[model samples]
Target: YAKTSRTELLHFTVGGKDAGWMDKRAFTATLDKATYSKMSRGAKIGDAAVSSKHGLYTKPNNTAEDGEKIGLGSLYANQNVQIIQSAKLSTGVT
Candidate 1:
């Protein structure tokens, strides 16, 4: 069986001040030998695939009235924000 897992940690700053860090983890289901072999045979160097699910939201602040924001407290005065991401692939098969 083949299983894949990945983790991403990011540190961010705003206006030269430390904002916070975002940590994310992703996992893929284990593949049996036959499925893994088929996938491996079809894939080639430099080939790529992507899978993702994400959202952007405005965090509420103390000034916000009821039902004004999506999640918990606001971000330094109600700034709408989303995470920016990049990906790199590494292979261990030889």
Candidate 2:
């Protein structure tokens, strides 16, 4: 395990790709105060949270039309779905 400090960013990978970094706040939020304290004292955080039990879901082989019918609330909504990052649809950069 890599040495991780409270202020340092925690890097994580999914499917052998760089998913992103978990800042101190986000990383702490995942655990209780005791667990965070233990980690702060040098205990390692396991990769169990990255498993299927977490929010990660498998994409279904379905068309967009079918996805709409199933409702966006469903876990199998769409494979290419992404969280909206901003109010603007496009910045006209292209």
* Leading candidate by lDDT: 2
Deviating ranges (above 4 Å) for candidate 2: 1-6, 28-94
Query: How displaced is residue 58 in candidate 2, in Å?
Result: 40
lDDT of each candidate versus the true structure: 0.31, 0.35
Tell how far residue 12 is off in model 1, in angstroms: 0.9
Each candidate: how many clashes? 1, 0
The digit string of per-residue lDDT tens for model 2 on 1-94 reads 2346546566888899988777644543331111111112222222443322334212221211122232233243323343422121122221
**Candidate achieving the largest TM-score:** 2
Per-model root-mean-square deviation over C-alphas: 22.3, 20.6
- lDDT by residue (1-94, candidate 1, tens digit) is 2223654655667899997765523323232221122121222222122111212124212222222344322222233334233222223221
Candidate 1, backbone clash total: 1
Model 1 lDDT, residue 23, Cα? 55
Quote each prediction's TM-score: 0.19, 0.20
